[model samples]
Target chain A: MMDSPPGVADLLGVLAYAELTAFLRFAEDATRHAPSLTDRAALGGLAAAEYAHFQLLRDRISSLGVDPEEAMTPFAGPLDEWHAQTAPGDWLETLMKAYVGTGIALDFYREAATRVDDETRDLVEEVLADEGRSQFAVERVSVAIKEDPRQSGRLALWARRLVGEALSQGQHVALARPELATLLVPAGDDITRMFARLTEAHGRRMAALGLPSRP
Target chain B: MMDSPPGVADLLGVLAYAELTAFLRFAEDATRHAPSLTDRAALGGLAAAEYAHFQLLRDRISSLGVDPEEAMTPFAGPLDEWHAQTAPGDWLETLMKAYVGTGIALDFYREAATRVDDETRDLVEEVLADEGRSQFAVERVSVAIKEDPRQSGRLALWARRLVGEALSQGQHVALARPELATLLVPAGDDITRMFARLTEAHGRRMAALGLPSRP
Candidate 1:
């Protein structure tokens, strides 16, 4: 009978707060950038999904006999820093955050989930399931780039900055919680290789959005 | 058939946008004001409910064969103005907006619901139905005011300002779209009397919050 890993709670807490902040930032960005009521409504729907994921994570934290707030507090600084440093400036930038920023975060979480217990891994997978609005970002960004080819240079650069800030802050968060970091790699895996895999997936995502990779 | 009042779609559109903007404003206010993670998560849950209501109204507008954006365009200016003019300065003020401001808006909508077709009325009623978090606002506001009795003075003033701005913008919106105004009163109903009833309910709400009535 092995002791349960401390990483489970840390992972859930970080994920909970991420979903909560994502709800806030996405709703705010949609308010500022949605071009029409239809688009605004769509973004609002996505924000709702984030809130639901937040609740699921928070509830899991509580069921583990820990206060949800205490669990989530450790990662707050790093996540807030990432958002502040990568704050989007316009509609296209907002979509990039929604697509590229959130897309990568989900990618990393999915990768980490594989190293945790089955229950937590199932919860992470449920949260990561597509909410169906990612295509809205894809279509909107692609169309905007098509309309103004010059946007390609600016947006590609923006995506590059997002990746850098995200990875850097992600490292800070991982170091601040070693249990969580340990879960970033399974028993036999290397952390560097895990990061390389994340970066490669990010490049494929940028290519799919018709943007230049890695600056 | 009395030509099935043109105001139905207009009413749904306006409500849709209100819910959408409320979702954004509430999420932003939560980020700014919630004192703890639990409170923050609770407010985020409320914002999610608002977004869900927005979707319901938007879908109803679409089912009416109207473009949701075109239908919502007319009232955007007035609603945005009301929010900008009355932005909350702290957690208590935010709760006031959530409790008092939202209470007034729901009252007005419920009153207007009676004047529309049954289908639209039902949709309005459903959107207006309690999301169960209003009690959170009530308890938090009451506790704060109890701790610092002077807060009642400021909160009462804030609530009054919210009502004034809301009614002024409500009039502007009604004047801008006569069809919607027509829905404020069914045949043989008096608009003045309806407004008086709304004002009375607001007074009662203030009293419930332990604040002075109507300045």
Candidate 2:
């Protein structure tokens, strides 16, 4: 084997841990912030999907002769910190966070997919494939925004903060894992350009939910 | 079509709510109390299974021309109270709760399944089918007991408490929904006999974990 690229394990590890945390956060939001049993079950379904992705990534890490836990441990702190800083306070906020935060992370990973091995890229794309669950958040958030126009400003600010915290945490992870950073923003590619692409995509996502990209 | 059983909706409703709560509780326990990332993911997988069952029951309720949420609403208060009263304090307690509480509930539902309509009985069997996830709890709890013999007494007491609270809240549910009670104990059947069977099954489950049936 030609040494499976420098950061394949790192990328998989980070994504695995991210999916695990996403499962946890989404499950927590479903239990605590969902307005009804129907919504609770809906969010719970999304959480389950995140967990299925976590299992796939973890199994892939194990197949690569790495301890899945050992691979995931390094990113736990930064990701946990990201969730701690962006914990949603209520139902609508929870939906917004799910929509905005997940959108950005998936976009970042999709960008990194281009730099990874074909096998790893396929895995990344598989994990990132939208299963129409995000559309649940979009519909819920959009309907909420329409029902109360004043809420849009607050949700937009929340979305910005979510992206802000994600970026700050992303920088921390990049600094700590240079190889994984290289996977995201290859040797000579402008980091600024990658970020702009992420930001523009995030803007479109926010617009899809009828919210502004900026607070 | 012939009318469904008198309490079929009630049975499905309560069971649906139970599975939903199970998913939420398992996910919460995994995030908050699991001792390792592997265990966390294991519990997350179990949580996902419970959510799948919830979805099935919810869909069954809707298919029967009943509102899923409405069917589930009646049991929410008592079930929520059951969870609120029996919240686990740590990892072992969480495992014990998962093993013991779920064991008793499944047993009760199995007994009730004998009296339900053919289609409903099949659905009940499908939902109650042990997917081997409970073995995860059994192994973990067993290992913990073997590692620290002193912990068994506390866990045994916890198990008793779980059963007691479940029984109390179960009685509350039974009284509030007599038809469901009848479903579990048909006119000619003895409730004491049913309780004995459930208790016997719970004892075997506790024994499987090397824990005392009595505190």
Candidate 3:
């Protein structure tokens, strides 16, 4: 057997938890926040896609003969911790999280899947497609914000906190799931460089989305 | 311009409500009721599929130049009233709702679709196929009920109540949405026959699922 890197399952487990939580959050936010019919329907459609992704992950986990919910539980705490610690304060904050957070994660998964076998790679592709829709929706919402710069400032601050908390939690996950970390660690000199690369990618995303990059 | 039955939209609207409520309830119930990992994954999978069907209804309504959510609001009360009155008391009751309640609804859609043009007929088939997994899941859960006679009785009683409330609410829908009633009446002596036919179909389904059929 090819010696696989550590933390692949942990990575996927965390991804699965993300999908489930995103579904609940997306629905709750729409039902509680968005003021228009068009926004609500678009959000509902996005929420539906999240649920479908959750199902796909569950199916993949089940096919492994391990109950998905069990494989899912171990990663819930750190994942939930990350989200709570970085909870988006307003509707704009929430929208940014949906865009920036899921976007980077999709990029990470795309990069990581190349190291995996074909079957899991296919699963990664399926999830990435779902993530792409969510990213598109958040971009649309951001454009809806372009007429007001004040709204953009609040979201920019929220994005800063999100990235900060995400970095902290990502480290926690690396510590907690050594194998997943090992899988991602390039045959490298320093973990710091890997973190820097990720941050570099994040800055580019903010520039593209018309949000300012934080120091 | 092609002429069409008024109830076609009504029928689809009811289905939209069913999918929405089913997803919401299953999300709550599976998260709350099921103690095991297997049951959670199983229930969540069905819940995800419900949202997909919900989207199809949404798309179809949009194609008709109606916002699906707005179209859905009018039918929400009657539809939700039925589900509340017919609340599944246990796990098996939940399964029966998906199997018997939805099963009969799908059958009616199929039978009625045959009278319409091919596009409408294809829509019915698409929605029914979206339901295929839930039906299979209900059967899987039924196996466990068969092993426990105690579970079987509770589920049977629940199934009876579901059918009764469904009939009551089905009538409410027809009375409330007369144009909808006319579309499915098929120039028959009375729309009462549609109700009768639906009830008979539910009865056979309950029997097939090993649940008691009568009030």
Error of 1 at B45 (Å): 1.4
- Give stretches of model 1 more than 4 Å off: A1-3, B1-3
Model 3 lDDT tens row, B61-91? 7787766767677787877687678666666
**Number of the top lDDT candidate:** 2
TM-score of each: 0.95, 0.96, 0.80
Residue ranges of candidate 2 with Cα displaced over 4 Å: A1-3
Q: How much is the TM-score of the A chain of model 3?
A: 0.87
Over A51-169, each residue of candidate 3 has an lDDT whose tens digit, in order, gives 67777767766665555666678777777687667665556665677777777677778767876667678988988766557665567656766877667666666777777777787
Worst 10 contiguous positions by lDDT, candidate 2 chain B: B127-136
DockQ of 2: 0.79
Ranking of candidates on TM-score, top first: 2, 1, 3
In model 3, what is chain B's TM-score? 0.88
Give lDDT per model, in order. 0.82, 0.85, 0.69
lDDT of 2 at B147: 90
lDDT of 2 by residue, A1-215 (tens): 14578777888888899999898889888889998999988888888888888888898888788888988999999999999999999999998888887788789778877887777777788877764677798898888888889999998999899888988888888889988777678677866677788889989988877778998
lDDT of 3 at B158: 72
| Chain B TM, per prediction | 0.93, 0.95, 0.88
In candidate 2, which residue pairs get closer than 3 Å at backbone N, Cα or C atoms, i.e. clash?
A: none
lDDT of 2 by residue, B25-115 (tens): 8888888998889999888888888888888888888889999889999999999998999999999999888888778878877887888
